[model samples]
Target: MSKKLSFTVKLLGVAGGVFLAAFLSLLAAWFYVQNWLKTPLQISDAGYVYELKQGQSLGYLANDMGVAGVLNHPRLLRLYARLNDANKVHAGEYFFPQGTTPESLLQKLIKGDVILYQVTFVEGWTVKQALAALEKMDSIEHLLAGKSSADQLALLALPVKDLEGWIFPDTYSFSRNTSDVEIVQNAYRKMQTLLETEWEKRAPNLPYKNTYEALIMASIVERETGHHSERDQIAGVFVRRLQQGMKLQTDPTVIYGMGDNYKGRITRKNLEEPTAYNTYVIPGLPPTPISLPSAASIKAALNPAPGRALYFVAKGDGTSEFSDTLDAHNQAVRRYQLNRRSDYRAAPPSAVGN
Candidate 1:
């Protein structure tokens, strides 16, 4: 009787183990089925654009999308997300196609694959021009549509009075729904960081008393010539002029002082009209930067090319001929400026960063 009782207990234990195994197999099959079989997304040919903001929940989005007829079953998606450990997703604009499944959409979210939008603040753009471009981008949420430069600075928490020459020039990328102020602040910080780096490595005995002053010179160089080869040359002439305590007499500075009323030409009357930006009359660095300087222009200003040349005239073909003497400079002016043949292929006008 004892042997029979022990055999019976062993048989019961074996049956329970088989039952548990079959239950687990069925559960595993169900998990896979729920994860793989999802309703096709309802979207048009243009696709659906969904925005996921920072700190938003995927479960909530799944339900929201379900109500919008994009998903047939939200609970299944939420369950699959929990089971597959794919609950986290990046914040950005997501583009979903008509036939996209819940599994695929969740995969994209988990992998942090979101839509990319770009905004460029090119070299030589003024704060106003850059602001205009930022406002025009459909991808970025606009913030500075009617705000003045002072208003923009206040929004960015910048201490300066003007936002003119402070922001860096580059093709900046931000996630969809990013605010314009965020991009502006980022660009300003990038410019500050890079300018400080270049400032620390600057050549000795530069005319600049501060990093801002060097930035001022760089903006001048950026607006002077867009040519890659002439940045240092332009920087050299300006540095030498500053050292000699002579008027910069640069036409761009004069044009900037003229404002929007300048039309297309600069006259003797315009040049003589004294303004804070008129380097031709100011006898020193402008109070603020004239344009957004490129990295190359900034470097050139900090470590200007070696020369004693104090004068430069446009060669009408995007080049400048430098001169150490007033007489030589006058000759270049006659050859380049007086001759109507002068294309004066000036860089995208430095005054307004056009």
Candidate 2:
């Protein structure tokens, strides 16, 4: 062959070899990226928490994760995200478990699956107790902090001086940095809706003149009940008392009236002193609900148990002995309160809200 022709063929061979090597490198990179997407993240066994700020891009998250040592190849992850059109990730705190793959993690971000924290308002808890609990939660923004009851009420725009039993007792879930006021509002709205619904279905001839009075009765029933089975029975006793113009004379009312003075027990003076919340001293139901009543208590107040029970006494075993008359109640009191057992307790362990 001619020398110039031989040189041209050698040049063509070199070009082909370089092109093949480039193609093989790209193919290998594609396979590696695919494997990376399916591989588990380098998070602790417990998990890792990452908070994606609002308006942040997926590339920023990848770079941040790379800096945090949780991601091996952030650039590759970013490229994968770009190719898959997964850049529009929602902003929130996310928990990545140990076995979480990049594919699952990205899906979670895209689906806005943020970590939810719970704030529980236990049954029979006072408004003060609920506020105290809200204050302690780190995730909740303390909007009520340094704000007086009146200020807080004004902030909520509620038409009441005292929240008291207006806030429903239940577990509420919220995302991070959620305002405390929002939590309170959620609970209040829930209670309002539930109370309205139950009020409409209330049993006939209830002594309550309005839904608010029924709420007061429900709060008393919530505080009095030690067992779930006895909620309606406890409600029945108070209902009969109200219908007969008799004082409720419940210990929880006296304890609530006593406030800071209450030392885990009630006294005759505490019961006799006239306070707005003391059902023993008040003519009828208290001015407002003394504690946070549960849905069950609310239901029981509106539709009390079908009986003529007028009184009840704690039986020292997380239960009560209900009586239809004062004489039976006195006998039960003598048996359960006077001749108390070694393990005497006014309420159940689970009924600590009382």
Candidate 3:
């Protein structure tokens, strides 16, 4: 019995030794992987720009990187990823700057640290202009091609008749393979959020009954002024007009209604054409906004400058002349718009000049 017990003890000791050896080998392998991850890639030898397209897997990237000398072996990367709980690479263009490590590269790809491309939507651009600008971008995915403004709005779930002046004008950043619709939706959401927020804070008894009307007024103001300081004053004029049962009679609204038919100039008959957007003939704000308004314009619409001035005209030097009385406005129009010599002017207020 004592001999049998000794044999069992020997067997147990051998098993434990084997287990210890295996554990030590695994520990050594773990240390080796960590060290391998720290080593910089040979990507510098090749131009250091790496572009990964959509639907690509980490395994494929590993093989590609190995071929580019960015990784010593694809298998090592796969094994390390499996062991270290690293995520799959994301799709985008990547620039591997100097001293980029395997670990850092993996982190960048897994965390989607892709290089960002930019698209700038300038203020006062019409929907047509905006769409045209979008079509020129090479990086953005053309998901919105051939879609009409109404269809685009339908995609966004907004039941509007027109797409003009809805999207916020700002610089947007995006990755490769990002949908064009996504960018438009992003800008629209920003506009909606801003409009709603401004609507909540609007001054009491303003003629604007809802956020949409405010947006319309804002777009008109945006087109009317090149100077930022004039937004509130111009908005105030429209607001007072709406309240006093007078037509806004803004020329920008008339131009928008004219669409492609608008020549370089507006005529008396053009103002009298009586389209839905012709504010000169229409009783209130246009059915929709006319252009992409800036945040300042939207703000001005909500918080219009306190004034009694009901008339304004372009001063031809990137400014405007505001007057409380039509007679005063006519003289200013004669001086500014018509470029006529005025001896403080004498004609009666015609209710038409500007």
lDDT of each prediction vs. the true structure? 0.80, 0.83, 0.80
Alpha-carbon runs more than 4 Å astray in model 3: 1-32, 45-47, 51-55, 339-354
Over 31-55, each residue of candidate 3 has an lDDT whose tens digit, in order, gives: 9888888988876644477788878
- The 10-residue segment of model 1 with minimum total lDDT is 345-354
| Candidate 1 lDDT by residue in tens digits, 1-354 | 699999999999999989999999999988877665565677778888888888888988888898998776788788878987888888778988877888789988887788878888989888878988988888887877797767767778975677888889999888888889899889999999999999999999999999999999998888887478989988988888889888777777766777788677665565567899877568888888889999999999999999888777777667777888877877776667653422322221122111
RMSD (CA, angstroms), candidate 3: 4.6
The local distance difference test score of model 2 is 0.83
Which whole-number lDDT from 0 to 100 does residue 84 have in model 2? 84
Clashing pairs in 1: 316-344
Q: List runs of model 1 lying over 4 Å from the truth.
A: 1-28, 31-47, 53-56, 67-72, 97-101, 339-354
lDDT for position 281 in model 2: 68
